[model samples]
Target: MCRLTFFVVVLIPIIFGFCPPGNYEYQTNCYFFQNNPTGFSTAELNCVSIGGHLASIHDGFTNSLLTQQSLSFFNASTDFWIGLDNLQTMGNNWYWTDGGTFDFFDWSNGMPENLQTQNCVAISMIDGRWSNENCFLSKPYVCAINSAATTPPPSAYPCSGGFLYYEPTNSCYGVYTHQEDQTWSNSESYCESLKGHLTSVHNYAEFRLIAAFASYGKYAPWCGLFSNDGGRTWQWSDKSSADYLPWQPGYPSGSGPCVALAHSGLINADCNQEQPMICKIQL
Candidate 1:
């Protein structure tokens, strides 16, 4: 009788759908997105065209999963759109424009910097945070609709970079390079060919770390921020289409037709001039 009771207790959770949220691939909820490319606004519209609006981030686990997959589809102009917005004009008042309120939000240290006249929000790095920016900007963003959710492709990799010297846990990842320099097109091509994409520098810590590894003294390497708005907007090479803005003092000068990494080994470059390149791949 005791054994039977224990067995039933164990099976009760399975029967009642009472397992804790987990990281297992199967246990995770899946989201469906359109492969069609659209501008930030258009993407939102398209998402509405379906039954859903842009992708609304739910929780850390789900956000991380979405960000990881978003990075994989990234290219030189890979800033896909998401569902969060600051349309209310209040600073840091982010809500899913999809008409659903979000319960989970992650802000970087001193984030939502609101450094500029940002009105929209986008996801940065695998560590989820919302960036405020203009909505008119045309960056690649992901659009989520109501359908059977699906997992990201098997090739997906997170936006986080590996360690500099050595870390056992990071052995599966590779470090960003200081020696590699390629034209914007070439660099992007390089990453794609390797079944990887350009690395996204999400915050000051990440920017500083990658810069140090690249040995930047006064030169910057190319990163993944670009815009067709005559340099008015910058987007990472992902699908989050998160458009809140973050600029380090003087950035997106709006002068160059192209973007590059500059500022020593900081992966900062002038958008107009050709520079060396870096590529990221699974470790």
Candidate 2:
């Protein structure tokens, strides 16, 4: 008689808890593309319900990546809604839903039409270029979340009062309420006293986090952007060069010495003007 031996093997699959099912990861974000057609407003609400906002495209690499993903995941001739719209203000001035700069635009010829009727923006699957369309039009859409980096265990950090830890940049942000309004310089000093500085927005994620908190007040909050050398050069409070300036169209005429951030856009204001402020400290 002969004896035989057998062995068994078990395999485990890796799971990324930061992103939901059917979502792809890129850099520090997770993106989800929906194939079901819906109006832009409903799509935006759907994204928010899922803990993200409509996708905001920032650069060429991101654009190409999203274009390829859409081509692969969605059907041909499917136009997708992005987080860009000009409904907040007049003219063709568009802004990302996260309050980011409209830096990269791949518009089809004679596109964006500069018409108020077409306020929402979408990417054409046929050519990967962008075009303005009526917000009510039904279309598929994309959503983006900041990923695990933006959501850490709260017990790990020692943020106080209104200050909250933003895990993406490892920074803490706070909005203080004073007995009296303060000027931009005074606000900066107050933040410095707290071992931080006026919040400086480096990208859409950071800007969105700050904007959501700053939206409560009627007045715009002073950020870290300002001009020195008699308005010849502009820079952040940390002396960083202005790499991503999203000033409203025809703004920053080198007039005012300070900058304030509103839901509409960045505006230059007198340094002495009194307003609320946003502060940030790196951890």
Candidate 3:
């Protein structure tokens, strides 16, 4: 009877997703820290592949929790990537990867400097405060799994108003047609306000779905692709892999901070140019 009780006590958590092994639970979420160092993009992908995203610091309590966990599992010299990043081309406003509002901030003194070059953020091992860094820099990272209800696929569930369910990707998409054109930065803000971001095309099928909604032979629409460091490195706003680019010939001139999809194909465009936009939400 004693052995059975002990086994049941240990098995309950795993059976109900209370907290997986090798993870710590704090306020309806599970967090895992990886010791291996990797770039910001790769780190984001790693977390997503495991059904989570990089940790998003909310308040002092959460910050303390993460800090204590880091100290417990890692050395004092270790720094782990968090989900906050400032990839928008216009402003230095940081956003969480989970699409939450930017309500809390805990930057170290004299930190988040060089806003133009440093786009990604990480938690410091010394004080557990936040600091901005170049996304290309490789580092260990923390993944956060929200304990809230799982998001059902588009086919399995319906989206809210103003969103169309795409069966192929199981995502909800919305097209924003503007009478007056807005810059890429402005469009991004608009989409975020609606709880989404500029559409990120991952494959030919997804690209075609977006294309079908676009006005034929008309101005292109802003997308999530852009040069993060002054045309040096291009990345998706959602941090997805950029392995499926289908740019038209002589396009992606690598001369602009924004990209748009026209009838011809994906093309580099000035970030300031006004255009229609597409926003996507993963179900």
Tens digits of lDDT, candidate 3, 1-283: 0110000001011133466677788888888887778767567655654556688887988987888788867673468898887653313477676667789989899987998778789888877888889877878888887665354443443556635565567676666665576789988887777777888887754664565445322577888889877766678876778877767557768558799875335888889887777777766
TM-score of each: 0.38, 0.53, 0.53
Q: Residue by residue across 1-283, what tens digits does model 1's lDDT show?
A: 0110000001010111222232122242224444455445455544433324567776777777777776656544434457766543345466576556778776656656653455566676445566666665666666544333334333332223331211121211122333433556665665666565555555432333333223322244555566666655556664334343334445545456445443221223445454544443435
Compared with the true structure, all predictions reach lDDT values of: 0.46, 0.72, 0.70
lDDT of 2 at 130: 92
| Greater-TM-score candidate between 1 and 2 | 2
Model 1 scores worst on lDDT over the 10 consecutive residues at: 4-13
For residue 16, model 2's alpha carbon misses the true position, in angstroms, by 12
Strongest candidate by lDDT: 2
State the lDDT of candidate 2 residue by residue for 74-114, as single tens digits: 88446899998775564557878756678889898998795
Worst 10 residues of 2 by lDDT: 4-13
lDDT over C-alpha atoms for residue 135 of model 3: 75
Model 2 residue runs over 4 Å out of place are 1-51, 54-158, 177-179
Q: Which stretches of candidate 1 lie over 4 Å from their true place?
A: 1-39, 77-79, 89-92, 148-283
Give model 1 RMSD, 1 decimal.
18.6
